[model samples]
Target: MKKFLVPLCLFLASMAYSQDDLLNSLDSTQVDGKTPVTAFKALQIVTLQSTKMAAKKEFYFVVSHRFGTVKDGFDSFFGLDNATTKLGGIYGVTDWLSVSLSRHTLNKMYETGLKYRLARQDDHFPVDIVGYSVADINSFLEKDQYPGLEFKHRLTYVQQLLISRKFTEKLSFELVPSFIHKNLYNPDIERDNQFSFGGGGRYKITKRLSVNLEYMHNFDKPDFYKNPLSVGLDIETGGHVFQLIFTNSQAMNESGYVTNAAGDWGKGDFFFGFNLYRVF
Candidate 1:
């Protein structure tokens, strides 16, 4: 028994010495500018869903220029010829929740909104549904005209339902149901403040390139000038997205396009617009 114990103790000591020597050799090699073989490497594993998650916070600013019919010839003098700029930012509070604020330079239209994902598409469910709301403030008009004004006047409210579905790997479409409520309008102009429906579609041509088409129709205004329709192409590169579009609608804001679009597509009055997006 004593002889066997002695041999086992010697073997254990030899193994410990071998490990210590190997560790010391590795340290010396690192210090001497030599690469050492490693049994395992530090690695990061990311799942497809985790890698594809949207950014936590995103900021976007776009300058949109519209060139078409001018309501009055004076517009040409001011270079208001047909130009509007919009600055917007989106903040993702959580993985599935986000909020956005935007201001249109045209007529000082300010909008704040929130978005939440209700359902995500998976192998069992083929559709992705998101809920969104936007509150628009139109600060162009005056409210103290009436002799007996009772309540403080505020701008109109526009609500929209954004529905998106992925039909294929490269194609997706969205349908929007919008409602607009306004208390007053210009006496000379005829407009309706009612619920409306709009729809849009997107087709992905490549990984970072796609085409979008959107149309909005006013159910209350059957005799209104015309519905608004826009078609555009988007190019996404790194942190910038450039959009070039052609549309018959001349209005810059949501309410303007939904209620006061006066341009005609058949008469060759459609205008070309460009949107440049930058992030810092």
Candidate 2:
């Protein structure tokens, strides 16, 4: 019995030592240094959604405004007399997925969308890729105004593949291949389907300030509609971001803004606008 007790004690000591060694090894383990590179600092590069997304459990509120075109000059106070406003909210379900809902004053449009990150910029991937889907509904369209207007005619859909890369600490670029489908259109005046390519970039000038430019070109669009061009300055302060923008697009939603913009940049028809956003 004494011999057995001695061996049992020796075995217990060996087990305790091994357990301590295992814990020590775990405590000494180092974190991986190859963390993925973040592309854009903000959730949006300008009017276009950026490859970056809201972090998990985070929410963002955005208020956007675009006044009438400066073509009206002082009569409209450089387009301030008529303003299109949008209120939007986005919530992150996970680190790489987010959903958003927004309402715009123009056309009384309501939009809902989902954004998902497909590939992140890391040691293995050179660019960040994201997929975005949006549905826009125009509620102000009255059947009385246009006889035979169907309910499905009020809906438009947009799908895009967003690809971007941060080339330097201060420079980031993005490209979006977009498809827009509208159910209602004046057959001779508009097409049911359109394709567009959007490009944008941001140049950081200061720690909290950036210069952004965005443009979208639609293929086979009507001669009356011009492509949209926007230039803006982004200001970041704590949990708030303010964008001072100049744009040729008064419509806020993807389908309307991309396919139906009437303002021409060459004619000085741009409008002054701003977007105030906050994260909570």
Candidate 3:
């Protein structure tokens, strides 16, 4: 009986030690705390950038299309016959930093930009802050398009501060204060610098679907241009986010859409558009 009791005692002591070690390992992991809230689900809330970012080392491919104005009616297949498209790619350098390059069929514009997250929403923070800077070059612009146009005249720069709040699991909103600089324009008629403000929001209707709305108001809009207002539906599928949109803007890039929009929503000049985003 003494021999059996001694072996059992040793086995029980080993088991107790193993359990203590497991508890200590779990405690160490718990010290890292809970993960924070993810800001936006998609990279874009319509044409406006959202607070979402790609994970480190991840890549995203986006395709966007905008049809002509609805004012054309059936004559243009509700504007589908005059579609302008954009192709873009984005890469994450770090969880907080990303860069993208895109080409818009409208104006044959090419754009490159960087976005950085200054702050993220968490239990301690109420909002997500992001900075955006982009340069757009109108490669399609020619001397005939604008008399005496030089190569430098094709360049436009934009800067924006994006602030977003996730009020609840199903609601999110954002505001943008943006500045635009044009390298060359008709100085007699237009200013080289302009200011615009944008607002957007999203509401979830289902686990995989949501409604989105965005509008941009230019402070000193050109008489020929119109403010842009867009409404859309976001559908989330496996590794893809598809958006069906309608907007009073035909231009897709920040500079073009904000400053050169020609469609007037009051006149039923809105266009139908869609965007497809894929992650890899």
Across 173-196, the per-residue lDDT of candidate 3 in tens digits comes to 999999999998777666899999
Mind giving the per-residue lDDT tens digits that candidate 1 earns over 1-280? 3764485466434433332222223212341243322110000000000011123564433345565454344556322455665666666677567666777766677877666766655545555555666566766544455544333234666666555565665565666677777655554555436666766666768755677777877776545467787787766544234567777666555666777666677775565665544432
lDDT of each: 0.54, 0.81, 0.81
Candidate 1 ranges with C-alpha deviation above 4 Å:
1-54, 70-80, 143-152, 186-193
Highest TM-score against the true fold, candidate: 2
lDDT of 2 by residue, 1-280 (tens): 3764485466434433332222113113333554476667667776788897887888887778888999988898888779788999999999889999999999999999999999877767799899999999999999889798888989999999999988887898999999999988888977899999988999989976899999999996899999888889977554345678888888878888788888888878888887766666
Work out candidate 3's RMSD over C-alphas: 16.1
Better TM-score candidate (2, 3): 2
TM-score (C-alpha, index-matched) for candidate 2: 0.86
